[model samples]
Target: MKKSIFGILTFILFSMNTFAQNTVAEEIKTLSKDKWQWMADKDVDKLGKLFDDQSMFVHMGGSWGKERELEIIKTGFIHYKKADIHEVFTPIIIENTVILLNRITLFAVVANTEVSNPFMVTEVYVKVGNEWKMGSLSFSKLMGPN
Candidate 1:
């Protein structure tokens, strides 16, 4: 009787943990999707709250921190006109941090010239207090068509 009860309790605990993990993963996925839209809209106020103070952004041209990135977006220097997302892979969670990879075709204007390019965008989110803040955003251009 004791062994049976213990086994059942262990199974229940494991199931609950798994469900919680899945829930968090889905939340992060939704947050990432919203982030893309925010970038397109140039909504710095919203983006600022989502991004960590020391967050880093990496691009083909250069790498910069949160404030500079927000400034660039606000100024329309590199307008994120649109993002054609191909896939958003399941995120890997390490304690309080989640790492997600997104395959997308980005449409944007740089130097007043419009361009479209396939890219694998890596996004890292860190849980802060009760909220999740973006810790890093990096773009890796993919070869050929998606």
Candidate 2:
């Protein structure tokens, strides 16, 4: 009876661990898609919610603050009439409380000077308490026809 009880407890613990990993993976996917949607709609406030207070963005041009990124959307320096994100791949790496999300986002800009640029992106997330906060996000442009 004790052996059976131990086996059940072990099974439960393993199941919980698997569930946690799956949940984090799903959250990463959702956040990634939401980011593209926010960019397309130029939603600065929504975008701000996804970033950490100390979030740093390194664009193809250079680096910028999370606030600065929001400002660009607010000021209309970057505008997207419609941006379709395709061929997205997200890989999650978890080490205790730290999670790393690697993504490849292929997108076509419906409007803007920078159009048809496909990107392979990487983002890092840190689990702070019960919340998963994005610590760092970066991207590289892929050379191809878009």
Candidate 3:
């Protein structure tokens, strides 16, 4: 009876740990998609909420911080008519108090620039407390259909 009870407890603990890990992965994916959604829609307020005060964003030609990203959004440098994200995949890495989330996002650029560019991107996220924050992002421009 003692051995049986101990086995059950171990199983439960293992299950709980697995569930918790899955939950973190889901949250990371949601945050990844939300970040892109905010960018495509130029939803500055939503985007602002996602960034850490010290976060930095480096794009093709320039780099920006939380405020700078918001500023560009306000200036209409990026405009979005419709955004379609495909093949979104996020992988999670946990280290002590810090969780690292890396994802590949393939999207369509609906507006903004005249030149054709790749929409596929990689985003890095770090967990702080109970929330995950974006740390770095990089994108590649693909040749659009002629």
Candidate 4:
């Protein structure tokens, strides 16, 4: 019957859309994990490509632009030692923008001393010509034990 066919088509379309969203979420999640590793390793070149030219980064100490962020990583001003990711939630805000929320225990070396802290990191990625570039990174310090 016509109704039965229409129902099937609708279900198929909905399923496909859900699948695509999941795919994008997974891709962004992987990229986020890779970004943590790259930061730990001080891979500025890779980070530069992943970060948009006008990207903004907000840290507990201060906020800065993409170039300054990269420079800090390169100069060991705030070396990322490790990121113990507790959870990652990726939500597609629009067709071209995805917001990734990461709960993590971040270890870093600052002033030649090691420190660990819990943080909720918000990362916004925007699609640009078939590539996703990080547009913003904001770290919110979490209270209590790390």
lDDT over C-alpha atoms for residue 10 of model 1 = 100
Which candidate achieves the best lDDT against the true structure?
A: 1
lDDT of each model, Cα atoms only?
Answer: 0.96, 0.67, 0.64, 0.94
Per TM-score, what order, best first?
A: 1, 4, 2, 3
How much does candidate 2 score in TM-score?
A: 0.76
lDDT tens per residue, model 4, 61-146: 88999999999999999899999999887575688999999999999998788999899999999999999999999999999765
lDDT of 2 by residue, 1-146 (tens): 99999999999999998887777677777876777678778887888877788888766767887888788777666664443555545455556344433434434332256554556566776666766666776767878654
Question: lDDT (0-100) at residue 110 of candidate 3?
Answer: 26
Q: What is the lDDT of residue 43 in candidate 4?
A: 99
State the TM-score for model 4. Answer: 0.95
Model 1 C-alpha lDDT per residue in residues 96-132, reported as the tens digit of each score: 9999999999999887889999999999999999999
Q: Backbone clashes in each candidate structure, one number apiece?
A: 0, 0, 2, 0
User: Which residue ranges in model 3 land beyond 4 Å of their true spot?
Assistant: 1-6, 80-83, 96-112, 141-146
Q: How accurate is candidate 1 locally (lDDT)?
A: 0.96
- Among these predictions, the greatest TM-score belongs to 1
RMSD of each: 0.8, 3.3, 4.1, 1.1
Could you tell me which 10 consecutive residues in candidate 2 have the lowest summed lDDT? Answer: 102-111
For model 1, the superposed segments whose C-alpha errors exceed 4 Å read none
